[model samples]
Target: MLFFSIYNQKGVPLLYYSLQHYLSLAGSLIFIPLVIVPAMGGTDGDTATVISTMLLISGITTILHSYFGTRLPLVQGSSFVYLAPVLVIMNSREYRNLAENKFKDIMKELQGAIIVGAIFQSVLGCSGLMSLLLRLINPIVVAPTIATVGLAFLSYGFPQASSCVEISIPQILLLLIFTLYLRGVSFSGHRIFQVYAVPLSVAVVWAYAFFLTDGGAYDYKGCNPDIPSSNILSDACREHAFTMKHCRTDASSAWRTAAWVRVPYPLQWGIPTFHLKTSIIMIIVSMIASVDSVGTYHSASLLVISRPPTPGIVSRGIAMEGFCSILAGLWGTGSGSTTLTENVHTIDITKVASRRAVELGALLLILFSFFGKVGALLASIPQALAVSVLCFIWALIVALGLSTLQYGQTSTFRNITIVGLSLFFSLSIPAYFQQYQPDSSFILPSYLVPYAAASNGPVHTGSKEVDFAINGLLSMNMVVAFSVAFILDNTVPGTRQERGVYVWSNVLDLVNDPTLVADFSLPRKVALFFGWAKCIGA
Candidate 1:
């Protein structure tokens, strides 16, 4: 009996472990083409290669965290939201036309800022400040804000779906029909079909689109096989080093020239530098990242844990995100944050809560990060495949947001009003800003616009007004909206309830518990020490 008990405790069914590993890997891969490629664009083979290298690094780190750290079934990658802001800062007309030396200085400064912000996040996790912030921000407020993210992304999906050159009306319809058929069928056999239906759907779309184009002449050999250019690789490496001075003079010519310099394995770009601007940006990034993490944690806790996450667990997870961001900065990637929606999706699909699995995945990501060649190969995936994946993921995000509304109590006029207006302003204000922005030529020389214009060139080009519209709709500056929502949800005359939700109580409980104290890992203790030091200093 004793031996049996020990064996049962130590053993995991092989099939279960295998499925979990594959799911985690698939989740990581899906984000590469879906989120990363779309934001980065397709033309710059060098940029694509570098970004892929970064993703590979991030992937390996994720795998390591999964294997050796938390071991949760989660994967990490470049965040889509950060793309717009970083691009705005890096290639914006405000900065791009500056002298090479100035550009390098600014880039270094920004890197510094990011590092500082990451440190701040580490502190927040360690000191349990995140929990306090959560307490102050009511769920009513959080729900609508999160919902807006979904609503904002939802607008992009249809356009993206339609924009795929290969995905025609009939093909999409057929794919949808196939998806429905798969969904309708139930079996006791291997659940792989259900588990990977979305990816399968994407494959069908890609296959159909491939056949439709070039009369089946769209073979792999026919695709562009040249590697990215050395100059492009060098520039990307320099940028990662925070040395922007060496970027190509002619942006257009450079892109065209460096279209074939793809290195197959991960190459080390020099370490990142830190600066004030980067610090500020990192702060913002960390805050947004924390918000995203909170949302994901809450969602996952509700779905799987069936209770609010203990403070120690939450802190550890958040600290991991901060650590990942630091690693990201060191490795010359954008930023790293906990992706709640993605996490929730993984949890829902896999139904595995073992931290060990996530750690394994993180270990895998760490290994991949070193392989530039492998990164480049992954980057070579077709763009159409990416668009399809995002369409499905974004749709899931929307569904999750709607699910939160089910938790609300009173369907009061004030509640309805807050939700409505928050959604509207969050979507509208940014759109307006992007639409009326002066031409890049007006701000900088026409030659510099492609490389300089922060929003990727002119907003009002021809009949494609959707660019401006979508930009304005998806803007994230919803502070005012958040304020208004908070007032309506918590401070309105009749809105206050008998007992308010204390989001931080969970953290406080963990911190106060003597038994829980024993579970604190070495990293968590260090995080706490730094957090305390920062608080005292402040």
Candidate 2:
């Protein structure tokens, strides 16, 4: 039955080509732990167990979707972008201080929103709304947004890479040397040898840290003390500590610090609830997520497809993405989205675009997710080893961005301006937020009174309401500025001198063959002009 199901759908031979494709697809799995674990941090038994189980189920769903839905070879995993926001939310005192039952209630609410957003995505896909939206939003706008994301993330990468304490000057030199050695070996027809260098280097570093170094100082565990029992109950705890007794004997701690400290023998599951404030925040998150997903899909498609994807394919992919997120919410995991540039690079190198192969890879991921020991084992892998791997992954991510830029028509002044501005905003805003508001208690757009109240507790009080109102007014002003820019750019006629020879040629082309220029709508034309204006203005 399984064989027939696999063979009949694509009308391809099952054994011959399928196996090779599967292997190629499976190769991409090498990136999962390397990329995900560092950002996620080491999970103790409880969270680890829950996350692992969720991973397996999600992996299975992803595999099934790849096989039955799109048949595009794409590996699905926990998205990295959501990590920053989620960490902030989870760490918030407001989330933590809620009475034991109430905290769980809030979790349900947040999860519910995620599920709803995801389902909306799937609905958009089925109804072809996503495709319509894509067409309406000028690619020029998207190009700048996408370029901004890369530039923004580049700023993030520097801080993140620097945070890897194990990554010393010596370590970087070692990584460079090994990378070059692998390149040389590949040229000399020693492909197998080349393949081993990265993994081998990581293993060596880990072994050195474990045995030669003074008790693995490079690892997070080595530096931080065990979770305090009293601290667990302090309304600031976001993670539950796992001890030998908790995992092996299933003993409850005497202190009982956290409300959810005791592990239920049979896992408890619940539906998500909703809150108005959280919903508003989620809506913002969804918009950002949508932009990011679209950009990633376009970039990947440019690399893989000979022509632009059909609207149907794009919609289906978006719908599947939404479906995946809904499932993730249900399973008590963070949000999921399309794999970003790093994994895309992995796919390109592996040359495995077979959906079935990706499905098998998902199966592997699901298996890894279910077994608590597997996650624990991975966590056990020394920090030095993880850093060694990340050193390579981070470099690869930067390279992917640079490579994508090569596909642009020209690295012109307008392109540079867009890239510069986008990078600046993404990096600067986030940095300012982090530096000024380390407490995580404050609401965004810090000028409002209701926001001040919202920052204080779960329910909004008088002052908080006032803060919220003020913040809303300020936000409106910003929106108006953007609206003005949009309107003026579209309605204002260009001066005759401003319309150069190149502009005249384009105009002639549009007039000569209206059908050929049908897709170039007014908004898009205006956006192109604005890009030039920004370049000159800058």
Which candidate number would show the highest lDDT if scored against the true structure?
A: 1
Error of 2 at 224 (Å): 12
The parts of candidate 2 lying over 4 Å away from their true place are 1-43, 96-110, 136-181, 187-202, 213-270, 295-305, 382-403, 431-538
- TM match of model 1 to true structure: 0.68
Worst 10 residues of 2 by lDDT: 245-254
Error of 1 at 474 (Å): 11
Model 2: per-residue Cα lDDT over 1-538, one tens digit each: 0111343444344333333332322212333333333233322343344445445644665675574433455555554444333433433335434354543454465576677667666676555555445533332234434433333334333333343344333355556776575545554333432334455555555455445334533223322233444335544332423321112111222112222222222114476765455455444455445545555565455556533343434555666777777766776554444443443443444343455545655666665654555545443443333444544554554454434444343345544444445444444444433343324434332312111222333223456434332232222211222223223323444332221112111323333445443565665444322222111211
- Cα displacement (angstroms), candidate 1, residue 440, comes to 4.0
C-alpha local distance difference test of each model = 0.48, 0.43
TM-score of each: 0.68, 0.62
